[model samples]
Target: MEQSNTTLPSETWANSSQSPAPMGAPYMAAAMLLFATFLVGLVGNGLYLWVLVMKMKRTVTTIWFLHLVSCSVLFTLLIPFFTVYILLGFHWVFGTGMCKVLSACTHLGMFSSAFLLALISLDRYTFTCHPIWSRRYRTMSWAQKLVAGVWLCSFALSVPYLVFQETSELESSRITCVDYYDTSRDQDRAETQAWRQHTHVVLFLVRFLLGFLLPFCIIAGCYSQMGLKMMEKGLARSGKPFKVMVAAVVSFFFGWLPYHLYYGLTLFKDLSKSLMGICQLICIAMFCFNVCFTPILYLFVGQTFHQVLRTSLFTLVKTAFYEDLDSDGVGPDSSGRIR
Candidate 1:
């Protein structure tokens, strides 16, 4: 949530020259979008969590999905503070510990969510492509172990962010949590920038390949083969769930791709200031959108959507109208005889 003093030249020029358009407009718009996204993510993911835990019977798939929704919910929870910070011109009033916690939570949730999706894709692949072996080995115990492994791996991967993030007083005397590096001891700031360049490149490549590209390719291939098999077998009678699953995969890729691409492209120096700002905005928007959309995709993709909805509605009506009725009597008061 910290605003760096290193403003792009275009931003400085706009603030100095552009009198017709208010400088805070973009910030306000971004804040509003983030807040709206947060609300949708919170409500949508909350519903998914509730249905998974309370309405749907426990199953391997539902258990995995429950973990996915929970991570997304945690991701969305960080948005309000971010929204408020942007609205307040990117001030960090939340203290250093919270800053680190929030930053780490965001990264952890992202990595964990991606890992879960990859896990789900792999599960589906095994279920569809290697049914016999999968049947022999794909128990709930295996799923639980995989989930635990994912959490541990994700936590380990995010340790660098937790280590590097710290609060410091900038030249403006404003306290902000930033990723600080000791480059002053080097010959010049350019050397530090060069080191950052290399680090960013490596990190971006690794993240893009592991987090985005590999998972997407696996998902795309698995779903493609599944669809082909279903079509060939004439088992497309239950096509809705298949279509929903495909849509979910497609949305997942499209939603996160722009963000990752922008993140990677930021390592290069060819992008203009306005373009960089736009990219940043797009990345932020996409990140928020992804957190909000995953649970919705799960809601619609799973075959249990209608079943869960019907059960919930039925439960609500029964609770509202019949909970107070005497079970022993169970007879009409005046129009019918008690039996």
Candidate 2:
């Protein structure tokens, strides 16, 4: 799932660049999660987008929610492209530009989501703990500016990846979009390999640092401080908002932790192929679920959605938990009879 891993050792990057992970549960999980997440995530994110845009007015909170759901919606819309690619055995017939755009959008959405979520958490903390300052300073215009800055930074972070990704024709003639990492330079293997190693370490650190570690810490810290402040002020007695915040923070952390771990450990590939393979499945599934389901988990965990019917467990979960995910029972093979 990690297209460009610059944290890998030079030797590993050179030797394992073309090697796919051992196919088993992780590979299958990726396929299943792709389909399932797309199905559910699309509906959930779409409904949320509609609600945030059409039903709600512009505010600081709405601005944050707008960007958060926007990231999820963009990721969900791209699912069909990836689902097709996976079903076609991962050969990217989508061409080089499509590949770049796809990867760019994904990375951008991911970065934006993480950053926006952190900003939202911080906003909540300030609104709760420092109400005076929040009332005085928090404005939709300011939030909009912040959101713009986040998008710009996300785009910048993802551009290198977009540039590096290309369609590679394997010796077996199977073409897949992958990061070539400029290993194609006229320089000898040693020079290119050295470059690969250097760039990988830098990229790995940058991606891991900005994309996950730093954001996670900030979100966790903001919520923790907010929770403590609310508890002192007796507002934490409600418990529901705390639960939603917990869900948000936990979902973000768990969703992408495996992804970071996989790439981080890929720097040392000889550790255990089987273990890494299994980790991939967990990572991909959770990550996919996060992109689509976190909004439901966070936004609806505190609210009650009216259940339209008693259907399967999936439908029941979607119904009682969040109508946004159901979209009237749109499954692989289903009647549009959610009612």
Candidate 3:
């Protein structure tokens, strides 16, 4: 998913200014996978977002979840750009302007989704661990502010990528869009290339920290603490909402971690050139699978597998939005049903 910046010899299509990549099974697989994922992700996220937005009542959890699903939906909408490029055998027919916009959008979607997931985790943690504190501060208005902050940060970071994207034609009569850090054709700009590479490294590190490592750590920590508290307090039994949260968090980590790894290994040239191509397909497939499964996982989690299997898709979706998550905004009472 992050292979847009690798520097390779002309034969490999790594140098966008040189030659297009040769047709191969890897490219074919990428195109097919992206197309399939695009369809699934679009339908799943769109339905889930609509339900959350139009049917559910305003609550802290619902607001954060709505933002998370919205980000995934936006990400899936951009999948056709990659799908078309792969099917065209790495020829970027999209103009330079679109090249920059799409590239920036991809980065924005990726980073924003991670940020929102972190926000959701933090909310879950605070609400579960310190119910009294959350009851006071976890308002829908506050959730909206956090959502805005995440998007603003995502946009700020993505601007640098827009400035760095460049498009050029190859000897094989194809145009390609690539990050400007590829120094293969810029030997004369040795100093400039050095600076760009340095910037790329710094940006990659920051992205890794913010997008994958830090967010996952917070999520893990939050869930871990919640688990300990649940057990310690004799609440060993899991609720429907807890089950859904686990599914969402687990799926999210598995989906995003591989993409980050692909970026690292490719950016550092740690893997062989041939191996990197395989990794690219794997990463893209994983990322797409992640986007496709997230909404479905959330929807299904509110019910049993047997329940989902027995019902029609339309019925199942309608039922998912009606789940109010009684523990979300309620405090304990004399009956002691609230968390």
Candidate 4:
């Protein structure tokens, strides 16, 4: 989520910076969500990365998929930081550098994921509708270059967090990490507050537009064209492809919409804490869905899910029944069929 550097009145800050209360339902639930998501994301993305890197043959498709899984894996690595921060009652024991780095990394993960999804959608469209052009230009080198470009773009978008995020000591002597735009200590209070709000509004809009809206449109449009092309060619007669296209677009949109909206609502000074907490819970749920389930969707549709599933299942069954199949002299015939 994009950080909003809104400067509220001192009373609001005092209320927000009060000593950590007893762990409530919301805090417990959020911590659990982050923990569970961290575990699932680690295992799932790790397995997929292994398969992509070690088991599957390299291709442009695999290249795109490899980097996408890498993003999830890298992001999963950051979840514990959040889990700890939540468990600490929102106090940030991590140094200011870490606060900035974590904020930037979180946004980097989000932006890279969005950009990769959009890239994958466009790649699918090209391969489907312009096979000749794709054959000529869609090479491993080109894919790598494009993926590098995506990372660069994501980093560029996230640098503002590094500049704006810092640890602010609260009224209770506890430290909290927050985005703060006012750096000039000598500036007039009113001017500083105005500049902070202005920066917040500007970065908020920039983040939403570039991070969510633009990539979303690209994905939706590319998928739409692909669907139409498939229909014209009779490849979409089964309706499964159309359903997949719709699911891809819907999942990407809904998974990230709440994250942006939650931060957007934070711009309002009068928003209740309870409502914000609910919005945060929704954001966490959606974040988990995006990080964990999105990869499964990608694998199911584009990564040869059946083949991988069958192979893994067969290996597991064979390992479990090794003696039964081999010791009884009933393993296989000369033709290699199971006896």
Who wins the lDDT comparison? 3
Model 3's TM-score against the true structure: 0.87
Per-candidate count of clashing residue pairs (backbone under 3 Å): 0, 3, 0, 0
Tens-place lDDT per residue, model 4, 1-339, is: 223101101111112323244567777886798788788878877877776676544666567667777877877787787677667777778898987787787778777777887897888778778978877887779889999999999899889878877777765666766667523244568878888888878877887898789989998898778879888888742232333444545666777788778768867868777777676677777777766675456445433546657655433222211112211233334664434
- Candidate 4 weakest lDDT stretch, 10 residues: 4-13
Candidate 2 local Cα displacement, residue 288, angstroms: 2.5
Candidate 2 lDDT, tens digit per residue, 94-178? 7888877777777787688789878877877777788788777877688888999999999999887666666667666666666
Q: Residue 300 CA error for candidate 4 (Å)?
A: 5.3
Decreasing TM-score order of the candidates: 3, 4, 2, 1
Structural similarity to truth (TM-score) of each candidate: 0.76, 0.79, 0.87, 0.80
TM-score: model 4 vs. ground truth = 0.80
Please identify model 1 stretches exceeding 4 Å from their true place: 1-23, 181-193, 237-244, 300-339
Clashes by residue pair, model 2: 6-200, 6-201, 7-200
Which segments of model 4 are wrong by more than 4 Å? 1-21, 181-188, 237-250, 298-339
Candidate number achieving the greatest TM-score relative to the actual structure: 3
